[model samples]
Target chain A: MHSPGDKDNGEIEALIQMMSRLPGLGPRSARRIVLHLIRRRAGQMAQLATLLASVAESSRECLACGNVTQSDICPICQDPSRATGEICVVTDVADLWALERGRAFRGRYHVLGGSLSALDEIGPEDLRIPELINRITDENVTEVILALSATVEGQTTAHYIADALAPTQVAITGLAQGVPIGGELDYLDDGTITAALRARRKF
Target chain B: MHSPGDKDNGEIEALIQMMSRLPGLGPRSARRIVLHLIRRRAGQMAQLATLLASVAESSRECLACGNVTQSDICPICQDPSRATGEICVVTDVADLWALERGRAFRGRYHVLGGSLSALDEIGPEDLRIPELINRITDENVTEVILALSATVEGQTTAHYIADALAPTQVAITGLAQGVPIGGELDYLDDGTITAALRARRKF
Candidate 1:
């Protein structure tokens, strides 16, 4: 037989379970956030629910560049001002967002959706790699900057894309390897230190 | 003039802002969660939105003990098996949930909503202290367990309640101070170690 407490309080428990599944939230933090939301029911909770629904309904991958957008085409892909003939290729939309936040790159972006993973059985078609190559020719892209992570899988995907785009003869570059801003050399791993030393520029 | 990217993406930005306001989530993590949700729109995202809306509409504080419930009275208070004439007083519903998870305490609970804080100007009347005293006589409560935190405000609230319930001559108790299971002595702070030492059992 179901316990009285368990039977009657299933909704709250279910909400907690769903929230706990979100990235960066565990069971303890989920409980705290749920209670906090419930207490602010009139304001934050209602606002959050509305936002979640609207975002879920409206948010979609940009048909052209694979960036998230509320419309058919993401802002960057549609904006004439961003057409600098340079496409920054990133592994995910989050990276695209990060590049936008930096405000340093005036060019557009191509989100790969994810890196190629053989172990996970993910291939070029699994991501937006074919779409990216198609965009280079159709959009008359002059350069492609590979802003992928420096992991082994990231390198493998970058190399595959580079070979594919070699026929197009577009200038492809990866992000510079170096000590990050505010990163101490002593705390950095041997591999990073070596990469940084090799790629060191003259002041 | 609005930036091309910023103007069209207001809804996504608003969603991120609201998500960032949630406890334990910052702007970066909020963006990550939002992106993840958007990607999982067909399943987890829609499910979470539905649950949030339903929980917001249905969940209400129990009229008796202030526990969150779909009904007027919470399950613990309504359960015939829980009428043990003993009440566990907790500073928050999370604590009540934790105690219930232990299953060591079979009695019902009284949620104070929060501890009294002089600096924050939270008084006895701000909590459910008055209702608790009334419950003692109305429910024929035999014992009151103060399962509040070991913070100063928690102790002050416990002492105040102890004094208030003295006239009824009911047995009062607090959670024992001790080294938690799987807790290492080296990792424990001075205060916890001291408390554990003082309350050491002759095992």
Candidate 2:
């Protein structure tokens, strides 16, 4: 006969499998993370649960810049001080968060949902290219920073964006090539990000 | 006014806050984690959500051992293969995970929920001490491995459990000294944990 607590084994098993899908996390790690969360429920787990429920309901892509935001515009775009006529474009929200952690950049950001995926049929339309063009004139953006990944696709995308915005007369720039930042963000110290941001140059 | 996808800010904010609460993670990291999860919704986030929802609904305390599981009797307790007449008591599930990661221990584990905290008003009843004592003879346990931290509270709790189990004839042992673990990273080289496990001494 199954007991009261045993009833949730199926649920826990499903949860473990789901957690296993996370990046850098496998089924074993997923089970461990879930167990840890459950054990600390009153403090960390409860708060996480409420947040997960709410975010699962409220999270959406920003209409203008494509940043993950709770509102139509991300905090960076909404902030008046950040509208210094500069829009730093990045591949994903993780890169945006890395920039934010450095706290060195004063301008805003435009997240390009993803890089141009040739094998995956991802093109400019698949990204925020059009929205970025519209935002330039609409918001008096004087400069566009191509803070994309250093991968082949990232560079191709950067060149594509630079060419697309060629007529806009905007001061286009990209993060420095010597700084080494594309796939790995968690490993870089805060100061390295700050340095890279400081040394960004025209694309 | 209202953008097409501007409806879910509240949920996103809640998720960001929850992610921030994780150890070694902050607001920025949480935002990134949420965004990463969202982008992979089909294969990752959806599964994670379902798992979280179900685990949130069904998780409970392991009545006999204090391990957080989905049943009154945990898998370790119910497993006939684990009926080796030995129980390795620990402070939390993380320790158990650490032990499992090593693939060293063959017997079952009894999590203590937490160490006895005088400052926190935690006594023997607050932990699974009495339950652990009851399992000694009932399970015909030959040894009790006190796989607890080397902290003052951990040592004290170990001593208390050892003292409580004194009436029984089971051999009581503990994890060795000079090896420290706070369950912060959980990424120690397997050999280190294995060495520590092998070097374990009597309490």
Model 1: residues >4 Å from true position, as ranges? Answer: A1-7, A179-203, B1-7, B179-203
> Which candidate tops DockQ?
1
- fnat, candidate 2? 0.31
lDDT of 1 by residue, B82-173 (tens): 98998988888877776666556778899998989989999999999999999999999988887766667787898999999999998887
Each candidate's lDDT (Cα)? Answer: 0.79, 0.75
Q: Which ten residues in a row have the lowest lDDT in candidate 2 chain A?
A: A1-10
User: Candidate 1, overall lDDT?
Assistant: 0.79
Cα lDDT tens digits for candidate 2, A1-203: 33334343577667767656555567656666777777675666666655565555555677777777766666666666776888999887778778777898898889887889789899999898999999889999999988877778888999999999999999998887445645554346678878777888878
Error of 1 at B84 (Å): 0.1
DockQ of each: 0.46, 0.26
The ten-residue window of minimal lDDT in model 2 chain B covers B1-10
DockQ of 2: 0.26
Residue pairs in candidate 1 whose N, alpha carbon or C atoms collide under 3 angstroms: none
